[model samples]
Target: MSLARPRALVFDWDNTLVDSWGTIHAALNTMFARMGHEPWTLDETQLKVRKSLRDAFPAMFGDRWEEARDLYLQAFEALHIERLSPLPDAEVLVQAIVARGHYLALVSNKTGRLLRDEVAALGWGHYFAKVIGAGDAVRDKPDRAPVDLALDGSGIAAGPAVWFVGDTGIDMACALNAGCVPILVHGPEGGLLRDEEFADATPARHFRDCMALAREISQ
Candidate 1:
């Protein structure tokens, strides 16, 4: 794909840099069962988990959303680190970018403390200048507030010089909303936003995985 080096890169954590779907799916099901709600299949989890818990839980759990949120956090906190899985070549890409001296930040829908813990667990915390997550900003992804927080003090304005990379439509929408270049990081094995779906977002590029993206940007 045609490209230029970005001044800064902001990434979506789950499924973009790491494979957390299994852990996330299991944790969600655990919460659901405890709440006497039907558990979501893994496929359902992938389809539905695109927003921060604050943004999505109210609609999913109604008046009891706070209780469900607490339960989900308890379950997820217990299992996330043990179940955390890095996507292939993700670490290499992170290293490559750092080596080239590009600023890096993470903007995730995951709870703030939980997201930082996962990054530290992988020993990749040093690579990012900031790690903005749910509740870390006034608003979250697809709203531009988190993106603003992520790039703050990095000296890079949010525009073409910045790239927001992720695997989902929500991520793309966030990038577009923030006026950053949207780059889709697609995993060959998953069912996710297709090319047609991304057309509306006007993504700057699409790579099959981290390796493909690293090669292009690291050049």
Candidate 2:
């Protein structure tokens, strides 16, 4: 299926643009240890860690979820900037998209403060017109609220002319919910098994990585 050229693009932060699994895995384990739960293996972390803390913590940590949230945030804040790095060619992709004159924004499940900090740390604050993160919207990814917030003031309504790009099913679902085109960008980790991993949210197209997506977009 041919994708309509998007006038506006919304990106997910973590695995989509930056390689943050190491920091995220460590922080999650730190929280789990303090909460008296077993630590997840890196593989388990990759497989299961989705959803914002505000959305997922209560289910995992029960009445102590807020405490666990604090622990996780503390660990994440301490480690994130030091460990933060963009995925290969992700900057190239962003630049290419900007050169195409497409409106750009970010919608992430990461805490708003931390997400903004990472963008500034990477000197990428200028790329996105709006950077909506968890708690910035009434609901997180897979919900249309953040997407709507991200596009606010951009003069672009959510529709097929908007491309929501990310590395996870959550992002695809968010795009679908917002009536936008869902474009999946596989990071260095490679593509997901669509039938198994993306059963709930299918992408309109998948690229091997940011470079590949950039190449396609440039065409």
Candidate 3:
């Protein structure tokens, strides 16, 4: 990692900042059943599908994508609001990073509106200067377009001064694609991205959870 301090921190939602896996796993199974795919274990789901549904489902479902999208959204909508909760130390981490005068924003492939609502529901709207979600850019993370959008309105550009912190491979890919440093927060669940399949993904830093991340960044 660079000895240079970051001017800004970008976070990924879903399993990164919050714990929504219960709802997500359940909803994904329902959608998968509708799509004729078998239900995924939480681990498999985390590993296999990380993109915001609208952004990725089209490729997975093709001509039937929109229908699958609706089913997934319907399932997610029915449960996400009620199941959402901040991960351990998430609020503290965000506060600590911001208090240190670092600019902060969120970049997630989750649909833009849903991402906004989730942040608001968590009462975390204040910590972020911006939130970039799927459809907010022409292409989502792992594609660099959304990363560009996240850095778009910032006074700073994407580079060493920025770090994209999250739990999974997609988040790592976003940072890699954008040339931003990637920091992995192992998240509430045991991390799944450390697999050998991700050999090309070498995160600049790895913390067991957000609390560890907060401690490291605050120093």
Candidate 4:
């Protein structure tokens, strides 16, 4: 597969750009405990909870999805920023791309306001043209709805030229459903859970971190 030089590049937040797993794990553990469910380990939570909240909340919370949503948000709001940090090389990559003038957006399962706040906090808000998150559409990643909302009226037509980069299988599925190219961003040692790996994710190129991804694209 030929990796298109993008007219606009979109990214997934969380593991792809930042290391907020501690915050997430803590909040989720608390949320789950409050509901009398066994708290999931960080790995387990990442594996089972990558779907957009809209898609996963009902199944996880049943009739209490709304209540659970509030609980999760409250938990997250309490600690996410305190534990937030950019991935080792994300900024250099984002900056290099901005320098090249390609439009950039973020498609993440995170809440919209929180995601925006995180971006601004990192001083990286200036790089993204738009950031589409969990509530940005009726549905989320792997559903095509959020992707549609992301592209709608942006004047950027859909298809392969649009690359969706994230650290997991959910991101790959999102790209596939959206009919865009799927790019996996993994550590150089690359260990991710099963079932999220795509049969066709050739990766066009692999990078150790965002800086590496950007350096390659720059070359």
Best by TM-score: 2
Off by over 4 Å in 4: 187-196, 200-205
Candidate 4 per-residue lDDT, tens place, 1-219, comes to 356588767788999999878888888888888888898987787666677666788998899988888888899999988788998878888888788887778989999899998998888888887888888888788777777777777788667778778887777778888878777777325443333355554344445678768876686
Cα lDDT for residue 14, model 2? 95
Looking at model 3, residue 183 earns an lDDT score of: 87
Writing each residue's lDDT as its tens digit, candidate 1 over 36-126 gives 9998888888887889999999998899999999999999999999888899999999988898899999999999999999999989889
Local distance difference test values of all predictions, in order: 0.89, 0.92, 0.83, 0.78
**lDDT tens digits by residue: candidate 3, 36-68:** 988889888767778777767878889999898
Better of 2 and 4 by lDDT: 2
TM-score of 3: 0.91
Model 2: lDDT to the true structure: 0.92
* Model 3 accuracy (lDDT, Cα): 0.83
List runs of model 2 lying over 4 Å from the truth: 187-194
lDDT of 4 at 128: 84
Best by lDDT: 2
Ranking by lDDT: 2, 1, 3, 4
Candidate 2: tens digits of C-alpha lDDT, residues 1-219: 688899999999999999999999999999888888999999999888889999999998889989999999999999999999999999999999999999999999999999999999999999999999999999998899999999999899999999999988888999999999999998324445534668778789989889999998899
